[model samples]
Target chain A: MTALTPPATVTADGVIVIDHLTKRFGPVLAVDDLSFTVRPGRVTGFLGPNGAGKTTTLRILLGLVRATAGTATIGGSTYAHFTQPMRTVGAALEAASFHPGRTALDHLRVYAPQAGVSDARCREVLDFVGLGPVANRRAGGFSLGMRQRLALATTLLGDPQVLLLDEPANGLDPEGIAWLRGLLRHLAAEGRTVLVSSHVLSEVEQTVDDVVIIARGALVHSSSLAALAALAEPSVRIASPDAAGLTRLIELAGWADRLEPAASTRPGVAVLHRVTAAEIGARAFAAGLELHELTPRDVGLEDTFLRLVGEGAIPGVAEPRLEGVVR
Target chain B: MTAALRTEYRKLVTTRLWWILLASMAAYMAFLAGIMAFALTQDPGSMTGGAPGVEAAPMTPESVARTIYTLATSLGYVFPVIVGALAMTSEFRHQTITPTLLAEPRRTVFLAAKMLSSVVVGLLFGIVGTVSTVGAGAGVLALMGEPTYLSDPIVVRSAWLSVVALTVWTVVGVGFGTLLTNQVAVIVVVLAFTQFVEPILRIAGGQFDWSEGMSKYLPGAAGEAITGSSFYADSGMAAGLLTSWQGFAVLLGYAVLFAVVGRVTTLRRDIT
Candidate 1:
């Protein structure tokens, strides 16, 4: 999990504001009234399942796909309004879009003039993404990972302030993923905003300081990663010969509201959430139940994520929702 | 537009496909000129069921040179058109437009750049085809002891005009490419129209006499008019053909029509 950083500054420039963005393809709603703000100074993860409209939302922001309703703006204006958009926001994965027959250097060089950057920037960015060794190679012969790197290099050519990357980690190997994480972190550390979208939680688990999670094309959870994990209570697990009695005593001791059977290979253990190990042992001592083990374990974000996306959410906690969406 | 054009120009030269296409088109033009030179060298009496010694027109050196000039464009115009179409549709096929649109998000500017660049390529195609045909045809005519009037002002004007005409035909191709982004579909339709459909319609129009007025407006006849090739009119195979100025106007109209439809589809629809 990422350590929570200081709140990002919401200035008139750099931050991205998505307000009630909606997109409809005939009757199927690709993006449904979605809204979120991606602030600079941190890497923000846009998490959702495969069909949760992650790509659609990103495309809408870049003006690749027009939204049916609402607005997605950067620096208080749409992407099209930017005088030189390549410098305002550089989107990766798009640069991967190239004529396969051209050399990688040729591919990058074509974009240099229009982006208002010098040809040297193209060469520099290729080196930045570790593609300088294969600069003369044809893009068609490149592996998916290499293609991803080339795309990232193109975005850097203009040295844009905000970056929008969609599923950039999809085809990357484990080492590539680690390198990409470090690169993204370094970019964010430079006070540039980075919005990376992926369906897998584990991929962004350690890299993202803040996350915008969605399900069925709507926002479900929006906050820091640590805050989402904190929603799940810390629990203690106990193994005893008299498991039923221990559970009964725990109920009588007033921790019943958060008690659960801890998943274990052995048969005599009940895990409790929001209950301390000391409290359970005290109650067990008073009830005269002998305990073989009393262990405290932390609940992970995986559990919180499952529940957050599922039909049934965690009980008694405020579920994240859009303005007009029903709980 | 200059920046975008420069970018597009760099993109075009980097790819080997464009170079290969240009070389092949030039070779085909030379082959055509060779065949025409051989046929013209044969005895005129042997070519026709002669009434003893009825000569085939005043076979002047200028007329023979004019025939070669018109043949260059009339026979080889489709190649450049296909190249233009492929240039436009290849981006969509490869999905490269995503990045292209991202760098320059405005569709109109990006597409206009493509169009302008494609026209310049079309002009290159014209130069190659015209040079190949005239070079080979004059060489063969000189070998046959026919008067090779390469210095004739009329022949010079027609040859240069044919090259310019070939370039415009390519703009028409760019329109076709944008109108139908599908590579195979555009190729099939263009081939069918130029090879079978238009030829059949032209013959049928001449035979039936009802559609003759419209056949003059067919792309092939308009091309012949622009090149000032009276091959069809002198042969009595076509009548009611438009003047050279009218042909130029009609060709521009077709280009505009193709461009308009393509612009609408591209502008209104999503790149995805």
Candidate 2:
């Protein structure tokens, strides 16, 4: 209520607690007893497969959907408890969550009052999102990228302490993605808790401070980005003309328990985890196995995400990629 | 609540639907009233049965008010109802309800604000239709040297009641919108019931002794009571409808019934 600070009823540090949250739609369990906490002053990535209940959870947290059991709270209070919720939280669930006939400014105008924000602030947020040029453009005519910016502008209109964005980079070009990355980082630096959900691993890798990855309506992994990065162990990848001989020699040498199976590569390539390339090269020479390809592999966040959700986790659905359209 | 009201008001004005429906209703009522006045002036005893309501009523100043009230209710009620329906339906249709509920997650506050703002729109439509119909009716009366005493008690009472009836129609429409989120289905059902189904039922009810009592409780019949206007002795319809106050209470009940059910469902159900 005072100046720019959030109300006293709001959790002091903006900690979002999803405690034993469960949701059911007839026979389908959309969210299955999920629990996680999003800390303040950090960007938390809400990652999941397509039907992993990411959107449902977000909707529940925002009070757009009724939870069958458990609770999702912001700062120890439910979203509906806040007299002016926008003052405490700003969520951009989707870019298309606006009337098509309304212009960008008019769309913001509709919610600005509800958020206890001034008209000037709406314009400021629009300019902040680089959408000032087309402020008067109707949303129906806006491309997905522009609409995304408009949605972001709406989130900032309240000057909220917490933000929940779903797939913020979904329709953005590389530059727009980069811009959003910087924007999220800047907002986190300003002491706001930002939870952005995305199915794309690489897109959220560098931007997020922590990751809470879910698959098939269950949490696979939840850890800080730094911890996950540190856990991504480098491996030794080798392909040789006498690949069977090399595999035999490596297995005989007893590097790690077992090598990760190679795919579609001739000469039977092998990737050895927790092994040095120099040691493999030395051992392969000693065994007289002529190597065609011997390379060191630096593990990335994407690899960690893929391994957690895993291949064939959901039947008839493609596994998340470590190196995809993301640059 | 104030912020929510402002948001709903802003939403109503930003779209073209509100203004377009308002104008159409006003224009349609004005033309209908003018044509009825001209036809009646041509032959004062032209009470020869054609249109059911105009059959036995004599051309008089009091009848002018009745004509305006009846035409506004019978011919122009659709506009306000549609405006109300679209006001609620558009939020769900365009997915704007996500943002709306997100901003202020309390369902009752949001629903209440929307419902109240729709009443304002209903009032506007009713006012416009009343004025247009009265203007045309009075002008025709003057041209034919008939009485133009629009200040007669019946005209005065009927004018305001017409506005009230229109407002109730809209409030009930909001209820229907909430009950059925699918805009196309709601529109088709409402149009079918009002234009074809309900009228046919009323006509058949008028012919039978047992079913005639059931017609009094129909929404249209309730609307007539609220407007405080009833056809004369031989308008090809029964005059044994609910009293004016009784009709007001009935429409009020319908509004509360539809709106409460819709609001409760919206509150409990997920927005997906």
What DockQ does model 1 achieve? 0.66
Going through the candidates in order, their DockQ values are 0.66, 0.82
Q: Provide the global lDDT of candidate 1 against the true structure.
A: 0.79
Can you write out model 2's per-residue Cα lDDT over A265-310, one digit (the tens) per residue? 4556778888889988898889888888878988887887777887
Residue-level lDDT for B239 in candidate 1: 53
Among all windows of 10 consecutive residues in model 2 chain B, the one with the lowest summed lDDT is B230-239
Tens digit per residue, CA lDDT, model 1, B1-272? 77788887777788888778889888888888877776766642222324233234444556666877667667788887888788778878888777887878777787778778877887898899899988888888888888767888878877887887788888788788888989999989988988788766765676556788888898877876787775544334455467778887887678778878998886558765
By TM-score, how accurate is candidate 2?
A: 0.91
**lDDT, residue A287, candidate 1:** 81
Candidate lDDT values, in order: 0.79, 0.81
Model 2's CAPRI class is: high
For model 2, report DockQ.
0.82
Candidate 1 lDDT over A18-71, as tens digits, reads 999999988888888999999987899998877788888888898889999999
Model 1 / residue A15 / CA error / Å: 1.3
lDDT of 1 at A315: 70
